[model samples]
Target: MEVLERLFNVALVVATLRTTAPILLVALGGSFTTKAGIFNIGLEGQMLVGAFFAVIGTIFTGSPWIGVLCGVAAALVLAFVFALLVVTFKANEVVVGLALNILAGGMTVSLLKAIFGTRGSIFGHGLVGLPVLRLPNARDLGWFGQMISGYTPLVYVAFILVPVLILFYNRSRLGLYIRVVGEKPEAAEALGISIARIRYVSSLLCGLLAGLAGAHLSLGYTTMFTENMSSGRGFMAVAILIFSNGDPLKILLGCLLFGFSDALSLRLQTFGISSYLVLAVPYLVALIALFALSYRARPRIIQETLASMGRALSVKPNAATDAEKAVTRG
Candidate 1:
């Protein structure tokens, strides 16, 4: 009972929310590109660049807000480059995205050396992180307070973006245009909607969102910048985007699921499990969940084929065809 209670503690819930914020932001960003019929695989790279620049910005300006802006600006630059390559030049999106990821990583590291004279990590003195919002008298509210209070401003923003995105996708004209372009490019072009322009805008929006996630990582969660600090959360966001299939509400649920897994992994470490195993727990759960989701969404043909195979293996072959039996009798 105690173990179970500990596993489901209020602190765990708070941790889950914290973990979800960055993933939610990035997933929301990825949704734009996903819906625009483009795959932006460089989210991880965009996030890294944002995280590094965010730290630099904070150190120079002594303001977390400026850091956030810098992060967004950095991401936008990369997004523009991506747009120029994949949308304008018609380069292979997958290849360009992978190359961008590599470039982001290398560039950030090199910039870190030049700017801070450090390789792996840099911490600024008096570095300020994003301020947390606390509900007044939250303790009296019990579970609700524990679950909702004391989060950074970005948490609230991320949650709010879900409904906003839903409205944007369903009600807004631009959203409709994006969908039309994505679903039927030739039709959209016939209507005189520039497919390349739409794609560019989508990529830019994705980059901006990714930048916010990176800002939260470097300035909201931690006051230091580390090499590859965005880690795989950006990739996880991409996975969430895939799972949600561009539905903003579904993206929220996916973020929560991944966030809960992350929080659980941290909680398990307190039970004296190997740190390495604990570190792998969230990813392991993610992999299993992704596999389960894929299995559940198996194509009708595949399921029918498997069912036919099972029937074939379970029962004997037809004793004889009707024509064969009649001929034998004759």
Candidate 2:
């Protein structure tokens, strides 16, 4: 009973919010690309590059906001490269993304060694972490205050983006265009919408959000840059995108589910569970959620596949009839 109480307290909620912020930000960014028919597998690299630059900027500029800008800028540059390669050069996005992830890992480590002179992690006196926001008089509200207050500004930004994105997708012209481009590129192109332009825009947006996520990780979540500090949150964001199918509301729910598992894992560590088992909690939960989602959708997927096959078979006879009619006319 005590363990259950400990596991389900206000503190767990706070922890979940913190843990979810980075993943939520990345997922939100990926949602744009997903909606535009682009599968960006390079979120991990973008995030890692952003995290390194964020720390570097904070240490050099003495401001966390500048750090965030640096991080975003770096990630944007990478995103542009991704766009160029995939959109213009006709490179495979998945391969390019994977290469970038590897590059980011190696590049960051090299930069860490070259610039900071100490690695494996980098932290010192001059690094300025992002400030936390404390709502005025919120502490007086008991558990509600604890849940809502004391988060960094980025955390608030991450959550606020959910509704904003939902409105964008449902009510905005550009959003409609993106969806059209993703679902029916041929039709969009026929309507004079530039597929490449929409895709580039979506990729950049993904990079921007991913940059913010990385900045939050280094500046708000922790004031240090450890090697590979992103810790697969980028890939996790991709999973969320797949699970939610780019819907902002569903993305939020997925983030919360993963976040809750993460928090619970930490809480469980206090009960003397194996660290390895506890660490697996989030991924384990993710697999189960994915399996359940797949299982639930299996019937629909099979029906769609069979229906498409039926259409294809029907088209063959119709094509033959049309050819025969043309011969008869001739």
Top model number, TM-score: 2
Best by lDDT, which number? 2
lDDT of 1 by residue, 45-107 (tens): 888888888888888899999989999999999999998999889999889988999999999
Q: What is the lDDT of residue 20 in candidate 1?
A: 88
> What C-alpha lDDT values do all the predictions have?
0.88, 0.94
Report model 2's TM-score to 2 decimal places.
0.92
In angstroms, the error of model 1 at 83 is 1.1
Tens digits of lDDT, candidate 2, 1-330: 977897888999999999999999999999999999988999999999999999999998999999999999999999999999999898998999999999999999999999878779998859989998899999799999999999999999999999999999989999999999999999998999999999999999999999999999999999999999998889888888997889999999999999899888998899899999999999999899989989999999999999999999999999999999999999
What is the RMSD of candidate 2?
Answer: 3.7
Off by over 4 Å in 2: 304-330
Which pairs in model 1 have colliding backbones?
A: none
TM-score of each: 0.89, 0.92
Q: Residue 287 of model 1: what lDDT? A: 92
Q: How far in Å is the alpha carbon of 231 misplaced in model 2?
A: 0.8
